[model samples]
Target: MATASETKATRRDFLYVATGAVGAVGVAGVAWPLIDQLNPDASVLALASIRFDIAPIVEGSSVTILWRGLPVFIRHRTEAEIEEARAVPMADLKDPQRDEDRVVEGHDQWLIMIANCTHLGCVPVGEAGDFDGWFCPCHGSHYDTSGRIRRGPAPANLVVPPYEFISDTVVQIG
Candidate 1:
């Protein structure tokens, strides 16, 4: 037989305990989403770096691959193509060749550039000898074989991304 005062005290204790439990659960529910947001899902597919085998790209041929979600152009130049690029005088080009014209160290034949046009971000199709370079059919922008702006509305040369030769047959573009 509990007294009235004892009954009230027990009820108050139980109420405090119930209130604390609900508060903890509510806090946990809110905190759970925040914790989940902070952690990356292990089941999600990771964006691994792509590697291109350059052996199949014969001299005078070009290959395009997606690198970091951008189209990257890898042009393997033949001796004649290299000569053609070198023969284009800087004064004749809309975007003249500076020391920055060359990207790779000690490799003059392998030209890597972003395939997007500098003007409107359109992908320029390589036309080989039509102009000895890329031709953007979108707006008639012409880029020389070295990716320099040769003609049209392109304000600058094609972008050159960082690249490295992993092996004789492999090139990594990032």
Candidate 2:
């Protein structure tokens, strides 16, 4: 342990280990950017989630916004619409989703769903369906005020996107 040659060998071993550690760190540093670049672009990531001001929409009115390359319908339901939606029996629905279940608990007046018809990709005509929800004229699919499939070719209800009320007037959808 006290010999000069032994001390030199120990120092050389430590230097080799230290250099190898640094080289591993350097390789990782070089590879990090390459790996991260493979992820989605900034613009694509920005479209993954969006916050929208819903205050401008009045009762019984709705607006369509693009989300992740799909048309998302955001409806501000009137009291009558909400009542009608709530009154429907579960047995009468083609796609049995409750009005209360389709909307956020406290914000029952807001209904957000994907606008495309379930049977086909046609956009439904709002406020024009048999049940006062949306009508897809392409295949005669009728949705209820709760966006539940009521009649015709659509096999299921309009898809509800993942969303939350950010504030009283703002909603974040993804």
Candidate 3:
């Protein structure tokens, strides 16, 4: 059997070990936010309005940008693609077009959408074909060129955030 002194020593050692473990966890918790702040591309800080030079986007091409920690899709639609989107019957769309759905006042060629699937928040890849839309491989959600939900399991249209055109070649997506 151990003496009283030995029993006291063992209890003290266990206490020290528990205290050290808690201290290490606390230090790590505090250090993680500091380390993340030091990262160059950290999004903890609020993003200011940014202007994108879109001259490189061809008439039929689309580009993706990270804005406020969300993927923004900016597609420069050709006249043919714009007509194709317009040709999609409202009866076929899950959410029929209203005047508010149109992003620009008088243009239907520039298609902008938040590149996130409405069902599960996955980024969808732009598939330019007969299924000319964004396809989410996660759960097979599909969005038309106008960001309207065409098929699959997504419940709503791809979001179109508040944005404005700074110029014919510059767009400010907030």
Candidate 4:
């Protein structure tokens, strides 16, 4: 038979073990959410850079592609469009950016920019503005062929996302 002191000691040991297990569970419960919060969400992680082939886009035509849940306009500008954009003086523009600055060095025919209007985030219609560029009908913001804001309430030019011509006919955008 066990003495009273021995039985008391066993009970005390069991209490400590049970308490430690419960504490560990509590810590895990609290730490899981904290640890998980540090990781990026699924959708955010999926917003990586995307690529496009420029072979299909014809001159004087535009195509809208989705990048990071936003519309990106890829325009194959005609010679006339290129000339018009290049001829504009910086003083005439509301958002004064040079046409040459907006395009790739050797590939002046390709004009790539985000389609969202700088005024209020509206998607502009292609080749509909006075400058033959993009027109945001929602707020009357007009962008020139080089995606510079020509007229309207928009405070800035159309955004040009980071892009590189991986090949002569392929572009990667981020």
Candidate 5:
């Protein structure tokens, strides 16, 4: 089977495959930067995870901060507020969640939640509702002190963003 034409054809096929592979690699190299640039830049990335100090926040008072373009409520709950949240029966809640379940253990005094109301994404006013939690003026949604929907139109509890205490007074939220 020592045919010159067959040998030429085999060589031609090998060249075609090699050319195709090289072309594919070239195309990938050109496209990579275009794809990677679409990702979030440094400023956006910096906002993705932030460390907040809770030391300045007074007991029975709360502060609101922006995280990933969402308003987040960081509350230093008073003893009465904590007691009120814990005393409510699970049966009375529209979206029943235990008070302890919403907060990290050993950090009972601090309560954090995304301030947007679950009903229509409206910012709820804190410590002013029927349950003394949060009330969405847009839809009359009432959230309890534990951020559980106690009444009105909301179907779920206020969202709890991913967060942890990095130090005694510093909290890292993402």
Candidate 6:
């Protein structure tokens, strides 16, 4: 019972609606993967932060923990080590960072640094370098007690990760 112009207009409206739906689907097909890729994978998301208990780490010893596929060193420095780090003049350092700057105000005994050697990503041996901090056996780089680069081929100091004390004996790192 519809007239000729009415039939043509209805067909045109249907075509427009159908075209819009298909275009939207096509756009979504292309955009979904890109949006999903921006999100972090499960393992990486898991490493976004880590909580550590410092109570069991005795003085003058270090513990290694995995964070974002890298080893992080948590050292409980002895009083002598703290004194030795503090005594070094700023001019002697390759990176020129003060010992107090590297540690928290109330808790100067805890030293936290990323465990890889800055020279070539090799793991450093704790308390073995010329500076009595960490030594990279692979390339002979030395780090001091404050994780400052002291000798050999490394261009910079060991990296310090973002961290905070959650409690007197607990620390959170990211």
Write down the lDDT of every candidate, Cα atoms only. 0.79, 0.94, 0.78, 0.91, 0.92, 0.92
lDDT of candidate 1 over 34-85, digit per residue (tens): 9989875554323235678988888889989877667888988777766777
Clashing pairs in 1: none
The worst-scoring run of ten residues by lDDT in candidate 3 lies at 40-49
Q: C-alpha displacement of 106 in model 5, angstroms?
A: 0.8
Candidates, ranked, TM-score:
5, 2, 6, 4, 1, 3
Q: Which stretches of candidate 2 lie over 4 Å from their true place?
A: 1-12
Q: What is the Cα root-mean-square deviation between model 2 and the actual structure?
A: 3.7
lDDT of each residue in 1-174, candidate 5, tens digit only: 785653445788989999999999999999999999999999999999889999999998999999999999999999898899999999998888899988889998899999999888999999888999999999999888888998889999999998999998999998
Stronger candidate by lDDT (2 vs 5): 2
Which residue pairs in candidate 4 have backbone atoms (N, alpha carbon, C) closer than 3 angstroms, thus clashing? none
What is the overall TM-score of model 4 with all chains considered together? 0.77
Superposed by TM-score, candidate 1 places the C-alpha of residue 131 at a distance from the truth, in angstroms, of 2.6
lDDT of 2 by residue, 69-105 (tens): 9999999999999999999999998888888888999
Model 1 spans with C-alpha error above 4 angstroms: 1-48, 98-100, 128-130
- lDDT tens per residue, model 6, 1-174: 976653446788989999999999999999999999999999888889999999999888999998888899999999999999999998988888899988888989999999989889999999997889999999899899889999989899899888899998999998
What residue runs in model 6 are displaced by over 4 Å at the alpha carbon? 1-30
Cα error, residue 66 of model 1, in Å, equals 0.8
State every prediction's TM-score relative to the real structure: 0.69, 0.84, 0.68, 0.77, 0.86, 0.82
* Candidate 4 per-residue lDDT over residues 60-139, each given as its tens digit: 89899999999999999999999999999999998788988888899999999988999999999998888888899999
What digit string (tens of lDDT, one per residue) describes model 3 on residues 43-158?
44457556788889888889898887788898887776666677888888887874236568654667788889999999998964235878888888777777788888888888
Runs with alpha carbons beyond 4 Å of true place in candidate 3 = 1-48, 98-100, 128-130
Cα deviation at 110, candidate 3, in Å, is 1.6
Clashes of 1: 0
